[model samples]
Target: MLRSCLSKVISPCQSAFIPGHCITDNILIAYEINHSLKLKSCGQERSMSVKLDMSKAFDKEAERCGSISGFRIGSRGPTLSHLFFADDTLLFGKASLQEAQHIRTILDLYKAASGQEVNFDKSAVVFSKNTDPTVRRSITQLLNIMEVPTHDKYLGLPTVVGRSTSEVFSSVKERIWQKIHGWNEQRLSKAGKEIMIKAIVQAIPTYSMSCFKYPDSLLSDIQSMISNFWWGDGAKRKPIHWVSWDRMCLSTNDGGTGFRQLKAFNLALLAKQAWHIATQPSTFLHRVFKAKYFPTKDFFQDESTSRPSFTWRGLCAVRRYLLSGSKWRVGNGLHIKIWKDRWIPRPSIFKIVSPSDALPEDSTVDCLIDKDSGK
Candidate 1:
């Protein structure tokens, strides 16, 4: 029964516990953050990066307090639920060590009010500069204190000890690609599928490269849905649009495939400072930027930004790609030159202007002139 309950709680594809009940806990944390931070109406500011540790929290104490809590103690799933106060926290944000220390103090107060003292020996605090080393040491210290058996899988399967970070990322990427290849093979292996295979071949460019924790069957269903939406019978066929490497990221827009191009997104997100510095006149960074890059111009005229020197070219490239598109005019009747004759409205002559020309001196009088008139 426990196995069944746990199975229901954590789906096969997911690596961690993510029950719906955690929403309130997350909301409370968000509330705490909002209460702690102060923001001006429209100023841009850089945030400090802080890493939090909460591995040593006591589940039994939380259960005694009457709040059900669940989390992957290490890296496994189904979450091993107890009381709400038992869950460990891992928070990372842009903030200084001093600021993080202040937040930690506040959290300790909050935890005490709720009848819990953070197991300090098993917990840790680190700034962005030392987070990796801090995390490794903290995890080792936490496992030792908990007396986790060498062979016992604490959270996920027994950790593959000594795997480097690159190895981990490579393994994850391999698994995702393998799943995609398996899915494609399954679809192509069916009988009477040569034509379907051809169609699938053509649609490969539009194939989603995004990773998801969905089961193969569910993913197949989603693909079928997309196929139907994009190429169903008797539908007007439109060209599939391809996205640039940067535009393909999910965070930039709502409708992108959930693929997060990590490095690209990081650069794009950082590029936000260019826009901020360009627009926010009152900020100290803006003043510095103006002085360094645009000594003669006011903030409105200053296009100078604090973006890293190397990224300026890529940023310009993305901007150009975004703007390079065919212009179309809307009309009452549309005409296809090759398929149908021209569709015309009431005939009128329109004068085109050169880039350097301003509006004609008497625009209304120009509109009144006959198309063929010598006047």
Candidate 2:
């Protein structure tokens, strides 16, 4: 009976009939009933319940859904034809479950009349009232809905309700490694490495451009200094003293310049995203992704990744986070592929690597250096 009530069919070519008239009718009926009940109970008191109904909900339905909906617009773009093409909505009031249910029943009747369907699978009730736990519980009970975990990482950020800071950080940590084990050395590139690093750095508010207070002159000056010192005519094949700019280039703790390490910052930021994926499955977006992309695999895999998921592998700078110091030794020529096991030519070479080069070689993703070949 519910299925039949929810199912309605409308001609795709027909826009003359109002798109959501039936739904609006039901909402209005619910509102009227709720108002009548409140008036009868209070004699003169005001009802607090509010109801909202989507109007013209189906106007954009055809375009948003496109050919995926079993119909296609013959035109090139937005000029296409279909039902429900707009995003207008109606807000009403309903005081009781019975009143809301009455609207639902009427909506079903409308669908039956029009030979259309409501697609309940795509709909849900959201509680926008006060920050009362009772609201969530009540809506869940009334709608027979199960709350999906969304914003699991956000569960740790800040909240006006029940979650504690420890709980948030704990959740963040649990998911962090899931992101680590998923990075791939194979498909990354020098440019991609830079991009990933930048993204990760941008995620943390402290390192972002938003943190800049005055003019960006401070940063611009530092960049200019480095460029001059590293690439100046005097620097070209010229003898240099390491101590000259050591104070400006190193960490404050280490007696060097207090500049941000772009690569390290990027990995840390990407780690945050991994934390979200592993911890916040309840958030709607993650839940949807889990349902569609990773239904069976535990997001935090206990088994080794013979092949890492695309997202996990996308942030390939992760291994750098696990390494100590800024530079790593290259054991061979720059032809090694970090993603694959076998090196093109095993060069047992050794050379000093800087934090800046923690990313792959400039020309390739996996540059395996044979420690023996560097000499």
List TM-score per model, in order: 0.27, 0.25
Off by over 4 Å in 1: 1-48, 53-101, 115-172, 180-317, 325-353, 357-375
lDDT of 2 by residue, 328-349 (tens): 3335434333432223233442
* Candidate that scores best on TM-score: 1
The regions of model 2 sitting more than 4 angstroms off are 1-60, 63-249, 288-293, 302-310, 315-375
lDDT of 1 by residue, 174-254 (tens): 444444444444433323232442344223322111111112343344344333332323234542535542343345257
What residue pairs are clashing in model 1?
48-94, 48-95, 49-94, 49-95, 67-83, 67-84, 69-83, 76-155, 76-156
lDDT per prediction?
A: 0.33, 0.33
What is candidate 1's CA lDDT for residue 189? 32
Best by lDDT: 2
Each prediction's RMSD over C-alphas, in Å, is 18.8, 24.5
